[model samples]
Target: NTAPRPWGRNSRNEVVVPFCYLDEETRKSVRDDIILAHNHWLRSLGGTASKDSGHGIKFWEAVNKKGDPEYCTLGPGKSWNDNVAINTVVIRHLANTNKLSAPIGMAHEHQRPDRDDYVRYICKELKDFDAAFERAKRADSRMTEDALCNKPGQAKLYGFRGEDYLMGVTASALALYWPVNKVNAYDYDSIMHYPTLSGDAKEECLTNEQRCHLVRWKDPGNPNDRSVAMVKENLTPSKADIDWVKATYPW
Candidate 1:
């Protein structure tokens, strides 16, 4: 599914991305959010410099002769014409759960092989970090600090919610799908990154007492220890995000 599709570019060298909603209802529900998200990207690419500017490439929405945004239908034997299809079912689920900003579908453009490795690395690291924490708790039942804080290969493990483990996995999988270096380090503020409190649409942890039960501390033995939210939800692209896009799709 991560395979690259050859989309056409306009005379201006802007990538023309054709897209459609699964149905009318889905269109009505997410049309605004979709447009907002796309416009954010467009502005960033256009270098408008109004809180969302950085990329050096451009993107154009596929339009008909009337100049209206085209919404094509996807079906069996139907030619997508290099169009990117958005599934309504998934969109509705995200909308209902208040995680509309979380990236999904074709937005992740990394090679499948690399994606698999990244996912495995993140999952294993988290699991090992949790396991080490448990071991330390079993030995000392009253520690007030994270035992794995300074441990090699385990420094990134912070106190994250037990229920949000999947979010961590997803965040890792959807992270900037490109080679990262100190100059282009991991962007914790990228629009693709999910906030710590994301996916909790029902506000399961509304109170201190409720939050206590929902969050998992690295040092379970410490009553004062607290869980940290991994990342904050970013509705717009960051400078690093634009840099990555420009690098990937240079003109």
Candidate 2:
């Protein structure tokens, strides 16, 4: 667990650490990726990669106040100011598996202090889609409300009532420290998922990521860790997750 945890250092010279547990490799990868991404962003700024607009350097310097205030990553052992910090990032690790997960952590979209706004927006959008679909129904096809979302193993609309909710609770706590907008759908199969917690599985649970209830039955691994919830596995984002991203952050 000595892996370097990198986060977006803000103008205030601080970062929102997820305090998440990740294996050595994934953690390192994330740290490296952040640096690379930030560097890439810097190179793209002022229009040319070759010319260090000093913007990239300045940006990282402010965000990366971890290791050295002056040198950024070029300073010494662990360079804290190495990249452009992205907000609302969620760092996650699995409990007891060799699952190869990505370095980028995810932010919980459901528990944004603005949670209600997202729900309203998504619900309205869905209703609008429902109406549009009805108008375009094929001459020989009959579309039912269930048909719109009742796939073999998916939730009807946005998992309005299920494990997505439970996992969201965990994300909420983690997100309090991060700067994020709350208009995202829940990700059941994410590293950020509660290890042993989930929403109402019976209502709208995916076969692979469903759970029966939303209680903290046991502490993760630390007996003294009185925390009620836990994360179980490494859940890579699914197609549904991608759809959520598109909906929330429209390109």
Candidate 3:
């Protein structure tokens, strides 16, 4: 789901996020990293610490469900309703399970990646756009189409599905779920952004040429040729990311 959780306030007026682990042992592996990462955003809002009195967000260990040792009940109390209780955050090890397929370091809001489904979505958006553009190009004069693709402003519309449509979909989802305002430019440095090399083992391409085949754009002068831009992994949230959270849940 792309909707934001209806988080409840704690005694300190901080938004309480009730976290649970499918494998309780996993908690030990990720606790420090999670706290440190969250602290970055908390500190940006002028909070002294992540869970201190001045902080706007607090992480609480969810109470375990009755008779179920593996899974813990979501929300603050016995009821599943978040509005009446606390917001829930569940974490699972994606590597250990065959039930869901996701990239090693990838974090999706909901739904795991299915190979066929992923290809279909990418083709539906990117290939459909290309097909439509090709039809439009055929209807117009060859020189007209060439000139349009060669223009700096129009070139972005011609051959960059990965940079444009794919990234646009992700950005739209983030804006819909998060408290961030819509932005014209995509933030490549956002921690939520996927790296250029991100994919399953089967999806990994050995060379840049092979990788560019998946998503590439034409340059202003090189209308017929295509180029790929590498997106490095963002280890932490960007300044814009921190600002969005601070604005949404101010201390």
lDDT of 1 by residue, 1-251 (tens): 55323344567555444445443466677777766666677666675322234322333344557765444444333544334344211233123212322322223211122222222112223323456567556655753233343222232334432213332122332222222123343445566443434443224334332232223223333433343323345667777666666655555
Q: State the lDDT of candidate 3 residue by residue for 139-244, as single tens digits.
A: 5546243344223233244543432223222222132312232342344555554444544211333454333223222232232323444445556566655554
Show the lowest summed lDDT stretch of 10 residues, model 1.
Answer: 108-117
Better of 1 and 2 by lDDT: 1
In order, the Cα lDDT scores of the candidates are 0.40, 0.33, 0.40
Clash number for every model? 0, 15, 0
After superposing candidate 2, which stretches have Cα over 4 Å from the reference?
1-72, 77-106, 109-187, 197-231
Order of models, best TM-score first: 3, 1, 2
Model 2's number of clashes is: 15
For each candidate in turn, the TM-score is 0.46, 0.25, 0.49
TM-score of 2: 0.25
